[model samples]
Target chain A: MISLLQQEIESQPEVIARLLERETHHIQQIVAQLPPFDYALIAARGSSDHAATYAKYAWTTLAGYPVALAAPSLLTMYQARIRMAGALVIGISQSGQSPDIIAVLEEGKRQGRPTLAITNDGSSPLAAVADHVIELHAGPEKSVAATKTYTAQLAVMALFAAALSNDPRHMEETQQLPTALEATLRLSTPIMQAVERYRYMDRCITIGRGYNYATSFELALKLKELTYLMATAYSSADFRHGPIATIENGLPVFLVMPLGATFADMLTLAQDLRER
Target chain B: MISLLQQEIESQPEVIARLLERETHHIQQIVAQLPPFDYALIAARGSSDHAATYAKYAWTTLAGYPVALAAPSLLTMYQARIRMAGALVIGISQSGQSPDIIAVLEEGKRQGRPTLAITNDGSSPLAAVADHVIELHAGPEKSVAATKTYTAQLAVMALFAAALSNDPRHMEETQQLPTALEATLRLSTPIMQAVERYRYMDRCITIGRGYNYATSFELALKLKELTYLMATAYSSADFRHGPIATIENGLPVFLVMPLGATFADMLTLAQDLRER
Candidate 1:
């Protein structure tokens, strides 16, 4: 029998396709309500936080609005000022029950800022406090790895962003993401065989840039959670600054390179990581 | 003889005082010339990136301006359009030689945004592109751990931020920082004994919040660099989101908690980590 994690990982493409096909109009209505803002504050945790990081780049690259990853302590601990007079605050979560994620939207509401909740559960506490909710609609994610849920979160943001920007090319790409994901599933046998070579692997670096930078963080977090491997994520360009020192002669570093404007830099970094 | 790391770690309060005493007028002039911005983009790598993280909270809390930690590849790798008009872009570095950091300032300049460089070397390439430079003046730091330079960078940003906001209490606190660092040195004996207790430990988590969130990342990086341990840093709020699962009974999770607005959250996170 196939592992639950593997099956969930393979479910991403279909899950994402369903998200866009069924929920595009729902997303469009929510996007229509949000007033344009100069900045965004995204609150999330774990895999959802990784998705927020991706949204930072995607929102910045496609829409010109800069995004900040919210440290919930600012709200919960210090009662630090939210300064959300005209900002868009987003909270993302898989379980939609994280108190920190819930509090961000609550604080956003108190500050009178436009608040949004992108979560898996429609009735989760996070959705309750949010001014708007876009449920992941990916169904229940039981495996601890968070495979389908993560990709679904990414799809939600991608579709939201594409609709907000009215970018047809991005919309088309979002529609085709499932087929690409199915192809990725077929690589499982080879990937499992490849993994067999590193049964005792201890520590490594994961690198990515632009859209895939979120992928690097997600992969690193999963590696640590599932396999107890020490995987640190870094931007490909940032890796050259000082982290290259950490790489010894045979230090295994993984690159989360996907075809994008950031691909060339990843290529250079990968080559340098191998050569050095 | 004291190790360079400890000596530098203990020099922060003094370095910060000197930075404020001598450069406050000059920094004030820079601040006077630059208009207030809604957001800030800080670009750096490694320990400097940690300093940037501190500045994110500091600037927001004190100056009420949100800051974004630039991924650098956003400029060099993807060449994303830096919608930086009227934005304050600050590039930080110790060596003043990181091509990625330099590229961020270059892009900032091209976008007609005000640029600032905080670096140890005033004559470095990063300075050449920046509209203004605040030299750390911590002198040569040959050690790889980045003890003095990191603290000095933190001090410089703090001073710059305090001056911009014209907050006297923060300025006074800045002046007293070095004395606190000296007092912290007295903890070395216990710290060393504790290190001896964890000789075989390979993985751990470092937690912090608000002003000292950056300290978590810096300490984690140093632990990985000097001790070859896998240490990951998380904000107290963010840590509770998902990473708290990794904590088992007796797991070694180091915290860089100092007395501040975030101290209470650190205490709560400590209890959670210990309980689970």
Candidate 2:
């Protein structure tokens, strides 16, 4: 019998495909109804917050809307009346049950700003307070770790970003994500073999920047959740800040450097780390 | 001979006092001259970024302006023209030398938005590009890890928040920081005695939330830089999200629960960690 976690992990391509197929037109319709928001304020936690971090780059780069992740404590604990004038508030959660996240969208609605919720459960309390909801359609993430919902949330963000940009090309590009994810899943044998080498590793650092900065964090979270490793994440540039001093012999460092704008810098840092 | 790091550490009360005495009126004047910004977009790295994190809570709570930390790579690497229509772009750097951070402010200026620089060097390129500058005034910082300048950056943010709030009470509270810091320094003996036990500890996690969430990261960075320990920071609420799974019987966790709105939550998390 396959473990629930492994089943969900392997089903991501299908999960994302179903989400894109179902949510693309729905997201555009929702985006069309929203007031002209100058920027976005997102509230989330765990893997969902990591999704927000990805949106911080993707939305700002692709949709021309600056994105800020909300300090949910400000709403729930401090009772801060945050000025939301031209902002759209969004809440992302797998269970959609966190009170702090709900408080943010509630506060946004109280201030007469548009509020959106992206979650696996459309009928969840988080969706209750939201003016619009994007259901993940990933179906019951049974494992403690959120795999399918995380990818589904990212797909929803991509769909919204595409809709916000009013560019058909963006949507067309997103249509290719399922195939890309399917091809990437084919490397699981090599990935599992690579994981075998790091079995004894108790600690590691994951690094990336720009869009994939969120990937560094998500990868670290998965390691901590599944393997109980003392894993941490940092942007490649931020690693140069101070934590780089902690690097020593036998320390495992994972660099998520896909061939993109940040590749050269990450490659150089990899060399620097090798020298150290 | 006293190490420069210790010298700087011991001088924080005086450094903070000097900053308050010299920069209070200056920050007010700069604030007065600035155009009304709906939100703040801050660019920083390392310890300075932690200060910006402090502002993300402080400014939003006190000044009622939502603050977002910039993804400097978006401007520098992706060449994304971020929407900054009503944003007050502020760059915080001890040296004011990082090009990625400088690129954020430069892009803000290119977009005809107001830009500010908070740095120890008034004539640095960062200051040259900004419409306004707040110098840290900590004299020469000789330590590799920033000590006085970090606190100085926080002071500047407090001053700005107070000014933006147009609240004399906030200014009055800011004036008490030096005395409070002085009192905190008196606990150095006990702190050192406590730290003695952790001498052999190689890794740890620090937790806090709201304003002190910044403190957690800053403390973790100090531990990593000075002791070469694998230290990581998380908000107490965020800890429950997933990272709590990584905690084992002997893992050391530092809880920065200053008495305030977040104290109760942090205390509960500390108890939870104890059980784990």
Q: Which candidate is the best by DockQ?
A: 2
Candidate 2 regions with alpha-carbon error over 4 angstroms = none
Residue-level lDDT of model 2, residues B1-276, one tens digit each, is: 989999999999999999999999998898889987888999898899899999999998898899988887888888877888778999998888889888888988999999999999988999899998889889899988899999999999999989998888998999999999999999999999988988899999999899999999999999988889999999988788778988888899999988999989988887887777
Q: Residues A1-276, candidate 1, lDDT per residue (tens digit)?
A: 978887777778778878887887888788777776666788877788789888877777776656778766556665556566446889998888888778878878997888999988989998899888888778888887788888888888888778766677876777788888888888989998987967887767888778888888888788777876657787775566555765776567888777768777778877777787
Q: Candidate 1 residues B22-130, lDDT tens each?
A: 6777887888898756678888887888898888777767776667777765656555665665468999988899898888788789887889999888999999999
DockQ-based class of model 1? acceptable
Highest TM-score: which candidate? 2
DockQ of each: 0.38, 0.79
In model 2, pairs of residues that clash are none
Candidate 1's displacement at residue A149, Å, is 2.0
TM-score of chain A of each: 0.95, 0.97
Candidate 1: Cα lDDT at A57: 78
Question: Which parts of model 1 are misplaced by more than 4 Å?
Answer: A1-7, A25-34, A106-112, A128-132, A164-166, A200-204, A237-252, A261-276, B1-14, B25-34, B109-112, B128-132, B160-167, B198-204, B237-251, B264-276
